[model samples]
Target: MGTRVSIAVVSVAVTAVALAGCAGEVSDVERAQAKVSASEDAVAEAQDAFDAASDEFCQAGESYIEALDRYGDVLNETAPTVGDVRTAGADLVEPRDDALDSAQAAVDTQADLVSAEQELADARAELAAAEAGPTGTPAPVDTAMPSASPLAPAATVDRVDQAESEFDAALSAVTDDTPLSDASELFNSAAVELEMAWLRLFADAGCLADEQQQQAEAAVRAYTTALQQELTTAGYYTGAVDGIYGPLTVEAVESLQEAQELPVTGTVDKATAEALQAELIALGGVAAQDAVASTAAVQQTLKLTGFWDGPVDGVWTPELTEAVAAFQVELGVEPTGTVDAATIAAFEQAISELQQATPTPSPSSSDG
Candidate 1:
């Protein structure tokens, strides 16, 4: 990845946390439950957005997947077309270019929704298991994670997945020659999914100074890529990853718009952009993976200070929670499951402070 995005883990930002005061008072379990629920809501929203973006693709005159599949080559290389007939000297809009942009947006939106759902699913399972068994708090609430919202029930996750499958298959079946109205319907469906997704995330992930900016940027990138990947994965082409903003992207956009029954113009207006962004955000926040990998990572950091004693299996069992609380006690910090920047830095500092520190390893995605 060419982009350099810095994550502002709130736990590490002590001053910021202090100034902000309490975000809310929720038990570790309660917070975890909320995050899961919020995640579920987001995925559902993404599903709707996916449907809308898909509609846009169909409206541009390409109903089948082949239009996206052949996007980069056809639009990037073809001349612009604005009218019905290819006249000897008439000014034309690059139908292919417009089609490509809309198509890519839809693809990226779908992926974000899927990933969010997965993450939430994992988190929810672990939280549920913890709640069912022991009584003592395993770990303090994860203040680091986004707080919960009642509106985003966990059930929505299934809806997004279901919608995605249907939308993708239907979108793929579209052809450039498909009826404009049908294309428009698909685009509208995708938009609906996307819109719902965005609202869910915004509500769940309220504004936190430390991580808020970082989250916003991440939301945009994740959604954009997710939208694009949907088309590419489905077999559409949207030029290079160099971010050139070329005609191929335009064509993909137009194709998607035509499919949605939106204006055939190649531009993505404010309403379109907002709708796409909202859907992406919702999908991005929709799911949680089991805290297993996360558990291991947390345990390793705490063990140096004797905060953890149990095995590191990615599960957030009671033993792990006790270890976390102990670590928090020693650090004079709230022992929530949330790993804010302060907790992370103290963990890092403690490794050196107490010679028991095992050399911390980077995350899987960090190394290569």
Candidate 2:
């Protein structure tokens, strides 16, 4: 009976040890399976995203292709007018930009999908190893994220920026002397290169857009108007300030450029604008000097009349403004802080009255 009891106790001890070992193995497998499940969920989400992106890309591409076909059809016309060709070209810009943007999104999502699939495969292998037992060794999976598409590198973006600037410079170089055909060819070629560069940078053809060109032209027109006004003030321009950049304005700009010893680009470049600004400053300084002289004269007159107690300095200080206002009040005129036509007329009358009111000495013979 003692031997049988010892054998039963040993059997119970062996069963407990086996159960513990089984539990540990099951825990490891459960953990690994959970990882695989999560990875699969991630893959499903990535695939959905990729599918949506691809659909958008396809739709955008089709729209752009249709627009391009229409443009080509216009060009293929037997007698396509300049206006027709220009309108067609303008219509193509937005669709092309949208297609490019959609293509970039698709490429990004595809990369994500690829990365997710790799992770899921790795997870599945890990689960298989966990289920195989302690002797099984899983091959290491590369968990590193893939690098970005080479098209979207910083260096490529920089190149695209440079290309855009060059295109702008080319557009600015156009003038009356540039032949229409030559200009068209130059712009068309540059635009193609610029569009391609933008695609590589995962961006739109901003520099090639008609809206951008219109904005630039509007800015230049405004600058030209201001330039014409300045030139007219400086005695260089004799035409009306109609804001139309005609030959007269061009001639005036050239004359000013010659006077300033700048390069004779009739259009107002940076140096030309700076020269005009300098002219404006110089003219303002002369006008300011004249105003100061006039103010000093007025202050002297006011001092003689005993209406002002301040010094005859040309600086129009608060004291000067107050004194002027006070003098205006006494003269039955609106008390404006600065001199105006009405104020000047009142000053003339005051000076006349003060001169007449003065008692002139007879001869002062004894005093002499």
Candidate 3:
């Protein structure tokens, strides 16, 4: 009887030990799974942050590009002397420096994204290892990280640095009162360099759409034509109204550039374009400028009012002429292709009405 009791006690003890071991194993697995879940959540949060940073960076880059465009406009025009160039460069210094800061921020954000991606990858590996059970080693993680962007990190950094250097060089050239001719070359080089940098950044960041580049190019050409027209109206140019940048056009452009105190490149640069626009505006509002600038403004205004479908390239095609005439009829004005003061006022009124009628969305409504 004593022996049997001892045997029964031993059996109960063995069963309890076995049950405890199983419970401990289950607890370990549960803990590991929880850890993996937490890590996955962290990874998701990091990814979202990275994406937001990337978006901000891209936006900053675009703004910088716009600033550059404005600066380029000023730089490409004719400046009578070194002092004029220096003054123009001074006007752009603040904006150019701001752009540089934005570019640096973008590069920093990109680095942050790379780090976040690495953390996410590490978390995934940990999760995988946890799922492999006791005595199972995790698979080797790939050390060579891959980027979806066309530009590698090293290349991106290099390009950004080069762009900064080029911009600095250009700014220095202007600020130092370099000869207008020499400064023009430096400015052109800087612009080209910065453009290359922007191209790479835009492509890598997935921000530059094919249509955007085309539209930019078209806008530039249109601005050039507008400049030519303004010069012609001012009695500086006698070339054809065609948008070609030929020798005659160059001479005319140089003359205008000299008058406006811009660096003379004989090309329709950003400064030249703006000077022309300002001159046109000063002449008598959008309606009083020579055909191209006037027509372009009217076309843009009409488009804003939902009456024109043509490109705003300063071209007076028959379709545009017809569109203008139709707009005129609607406004109870004479069906002349010319945009007179009455038509201009009517267009402005329509634009104001459209803007006022459009509802401003609430923040809460947009949150979803």
TM-score rank order: 3, 2, 1
Instruction: Encode model 3's per-residue lDDT on 1-368: one tens digit a residue.
Output: 22233334334544554576675654444444444454445445544655665566566656555555445545545554556545655665565565556556555545544554554465556656767766898767663553544223566556657667756665665545356565354355455445445544554465544443433333333434565577787768896553333335556767878999997765443345556666666777543545357447545555544566667765555666566667767755556654332333233223212332322322111111
Q: Lowest-scoring 10 consecutive residues by lDDT in candidate 1?
A: 1-10
Error of 3 at 303 (Å): 22
lDDT of 2 by residue, 1-368 (tens): 22233334334544554577665653666656666666666667776876787678656755654564444345334455566655666786699689768867877777776776666676677777888778967655565654434324566556556655654565455555555353342343343334433332332212112443333223323333455667787778997663333445556767888999987655444355556656666788653333234345445545544455666664445665666677667765667554432343334323222332332322111111
Question: Order the candidates by lDDT, highest first — what do you get?
Answer: 2, 3, 1
| TM-scores of the models, in the order given | 0.26, 0.34, 0.43
lDDT of 3: 0.52
TM-score of 2: 0.34
Query: Candidate 1: lDDT of 74?
Result: 24
User: In order, what lDDT does every prediction score?
Assistant: 0.40, 0.53, 0.52
